[model samples]
Target: MDTRRLYSFIKIVDAGSITRAADILHIAQPALSQQLSALEAQFGQQLLIRSKRGVAPTEAGRALYRHAQLILRQVDLAHAAVEVSGRAPAGSVSVGLAPYSMGAALALPLLRSVRERYPDILLHINENFGGVISEAIMTGRMDMAFIYGAGPLRGVQFEPVRSEDLYLIGAPTDGGEAGEVALEELAEVPLLLPSRIHTIRQVVDSAFQQAALRPNVVGEVESALTLVNAVDADLGATVLPWSAARAILDVRALTVRRIAHPVIRVQLSLVTSDSQPLSEPALAVHDLFLELVTAFDKE
Candidate 1:
């Protein structure tokens, strides 16, 4: 297989136009088109659908794009490994941190630690939802991620970091005091939570189901800032892990009550690709992440 053709194909797919890809690759448009044709002939499939607007990948092209990304990443890692052996690891490592969890608190600290310890290493940090981060890791677009679930996911491995207890945060006017609150008591309280796709929402929903009670969820909020703001405005109460609640809310200004009568806890895990081995720089960042998590847990 020609790696050059694969690279060109990826560029074409990303740019969405043969002319744009040609400009980016510094190759003639005719030559780039020939490469695309050769790739199509070799695969015996029409990889892309060309239209007046641009080129879009076919189903086969999407599959090839995924494989090509992994292959190119592996090739880069192999070169970096050999070139940086017995030297300070120097390369870029992309990491994802799932929002609305412990990741929110650790982002800045992790960035500072990496910058101080591995000056030669360039770190790319992405804060997103768990599903998005997980898919990026599975596709080899991310070296690793800290996510909020330990459930089995194909094409990735999860290492348990810690579990966090859920709490109810509300405005001071709506709450009586700061103490443990039962699930039954919250059945009537208007709630603001993330969508059903989120792991936190899934856990909250399951607890409600097991208790044989339906929560009065008034809104589905995906943004941490918006959720906190809504709760602060007395629009509705929200359920979140203690770390996330504290990181985004001022305890003195809000009422944070731990949920009792069957405490709900969510697992935090470090996720990595099952098939792709981390490069030296990525491995270094991974170790640093674990170390920081451990220290934070102790504190």
Candidate 2:
């Protein structure tokens, strides 16, 4: 039978009344009754008995109910499998990642590899916060993601890739790459920081809290680039992922200082949904992530 009829039958069975099922299904009671009648007629058996209270299923109805449930489940699986099969290695793979995480720099290497090895794979990358990236993966919108550790994130599996120390960044005039910095130094300095929602921001806040130091947040920007730029212009120094700040320090106009006390080194991870099966493109991308990790480790 068609899905409509099966749905009608199932609703009736679940609601135990034609009227109630019709209300729940948002169909007219008469229409539901007619559909059920048609379904039974198609099967050439009596499926329901009408009564004052509601409708009850017959032996034949019960038997068909079991089969119908399985049929619907199979149909759903078939549709999902077909969708997945359509997404071959050469197909599009949407990825969501934290802005300051490997999602930006490391994504380039992975993209290059995918292009050279699997040209058919389409890479769609979105920059977002860690929580947003996790949500995207869980909802099946993102095939995979690179996010910094947010403790134990449920429903998403983490594959530890690399760790980098969170460094204190300032102008070259203020401090060159002399060495590590004390938390108290940050407390006295004006800080340009990202929102507390960012994983790195949380780390910085925790370090400050541990040292019992309250930093003066001069400004709060969304992107790492903006935060770094603000610091470069001497708006204020900020805590940054080493990878991001290192690129800026090469400019000669900026200097990077390592945070010594309460060393807040954070781990970056490749995360994927535990509930969803990976597409071929997704698997290839995941492999490239591992390769990048290996290369980074060697460095």
Candidate 3:
């Protein structure tokens, strides 16, 4: 396979227009079209669906795009390894932080640490849901991520960071207390939580199931602001890690209580692609993240 054609195809997919890709690549439209044609012919499949809006990748094209990204990233890593050998690690490192987790609190610190320690390296930080972040890492679109799961994901390896205890967060007037509450007591408390697809929801659900109790979930909320606002409005209570809760809410205004009596906990892990080796800069950031997390845990 011609890597040049792969590069062109990737650009076309990203730009969503052949003309735009041609302009970016500084090549004639016809030449770029020919490269696309050659790729389709070699693969014996139509890779794109064209329309008035532009082109979108077909199923095969999406798969190829994922592989192409990995291939291109590996090539870049190889070039960097040889060119910057023994020099300060330098290049763009993309890091994903799962939203509403301990990662949210670490973002600013991570940025400052990376900027101070590796001035030559460019850092791209992304805050997103765990599933989206994990998929990005698996596809080589992100160098690493701190996500909420340590379970088996096909293309990624997870290093367990810590098990964070889940706490109940509610409005101040709604029995504002600092003591631990049992899982049984939460069965009747109206709750607002993220959807079932989220790791926290899954953990909460499983814990309730084992206790043979159904939680009174009043609403499905995915936004941090909405969740905090809903809780503050006395619409319902929510569950979260202390770090996550503190990141989004003012502890003084809300009631925070640790859940106990069958305490619920969620695993946090550092996730990286199993098949792709990290470049020096990425590895450096990875270690720095671990160091920061360790120090934060101690505090």
Provide TM-scores for the models: 0.92, 0.69, 0.88
In model 2, the Cα lDDT at residue 112 comes to 83
* lDDT, model 2: 0.76
**lDDT string, candidate 1, 1-299, tens digits:** 98999999999999999999999999999999999999999999999999999999999999999999999988888988898899987899999988788888888888999999999899999988888998898889999999988969999999999999999888343354448888888888899999998888999999999999999999999898898788888999999888878778886788788888889999999999999988899999999999989998888
RMSD of model 3 against the true structure: 2.7
lDDT (Cα, tens digit) per residue for candidate 3, span 250-296: 87787788998888999999999999989999999999999999999
| TM-score for predicted model 2 compared with the true structure | 0.69
**What lDDT tens digits, residue by residue, belong to model 2 across residues 110-229?**
768878887877788788988888877765567788889935777789888778887767734345336777777777778887788988888888877887878788888887667656
Q: In order, what is each prediction's RMSD in angstroms?
A: 2.1, 9.1, 2.7
lDDT of 3 at 119: 90
Clashes of each: 0, 2, 0
TM-score-better candidate, 2 vs 3: 3
For model 2, the superposed segments whose C-alpha errors exceed 4 Å read 1-88, 172-177, 247-251
Model 3 ranges off by over 4 Å: 15-20, 40-60, 171-178
Tell me the lDDT of candidate 3.
Answer: 0.90
